[model samples]
Target: LLTVIVTAAGLVSSELRSGSAALTLAKPISRAAFVVGKLSAYLLHLLAATVLGTALCVGATAILFGAAPLGDLLQAVALWLVYVLLLTCFIVLLSCTLRSQLGVAALGIATFIALSALSLLQPLAQTPVGMADVVTAAMAGTAFSATWPLVTSAALALVLLATALLVFQRKEI
Candidate 1:
């Protein structure tokens, strides 16, 4: 979670602070294109890290125990990836709006904590906020359905990304 927050928080604000965003925008690319490009790069890096980390974790689990449930592990990891992607989109939006990376990171962390607390409510248990519960259930090899949370999370991520692009477009370099 911290990884997603930190990486996304720096994606745009750091560039703006360092005066690189202005230089990059001076090129022929559209502002939307530049933002999308940065997001794509971050997603690629996140994918690689998630894959490698999952592989190492699985290997270690298998070695420590007699066997590891690959299906359960993969399911949990998939749900986790979806959740983290949503979080990354949120932090990216914050990064696009905020001038300071630290401010973005702080707000990102606060939002995470707030949502986590909200997820404790029964009414929000099926929402994206409850994704942690779904991931936990999957990891525990329990019967848990995450269809609503996954769908909502993906939809929210798309919305957040679009909003971020719009915000960046209106922002002054």
Candidate 2:
């Protein structure tokens, strides 16, 4: 969560601060394309890091514990990836709306904490904020369905990305 917030907090604010966004916007490319390109690049970076980290952790666990449950670990990691992706979209949206990178990061962290706290409620247990519990259940090899969390997280991510694009488009740079 910190990684997502820190990385995305500077995605646009830094560009705008350095005057790079103005220069880029001066080009023929559309603002939407620029925002999407930034998001795509970050997503690729996040995916690669997640894959490499997971592989190393799994390898180490297998060596230490002798053949752990790969299915359960992978399932938990998949759910985690979905949650992180949603977080990235949200932080990106914050970056678009806020000029200060620090402000974006602070707000992102606050929001993450708030949602985590809210997840303790039974009613919100099925939301994306409760993804940590679902991930824990998966890792523990408990029987639980991850369908709703995955679907909701993905849907929220799309909404966030679209809203970010809209905000960036109208932004004065």
Over the stretch 38-101, how does candidate 1's per-residue lDDT look in tens digits? 9999989988998999999988988888687899999999999999989999998999999999
Q: After superposition, how far is residue 149 of candidate 1 from its true place, in Å?
A: 0.5
> After superposition, which runs of candidate 1 have C-alpha atoms over 4 Å from their true positions?
none
Judging by lDDT against the true structure, name the best candidate. 1
| lDDT, candidate 2, at 38 | 91
Residue 13, model 1, lDDT:
95
Could you give candidate 2's per-residue lDDT for residues 27-139 as a string of tens digits? 99999899889989998998899899999999999899999899998989888888888898899899999899999999999988987888789787777877877888999
Top-TM-score candidate index: 1
Model 1: which ten-residue window has the lowest total lDDT? Answer: 1-10
Cα displacement (Å) at residue 114, model 2: 0.8
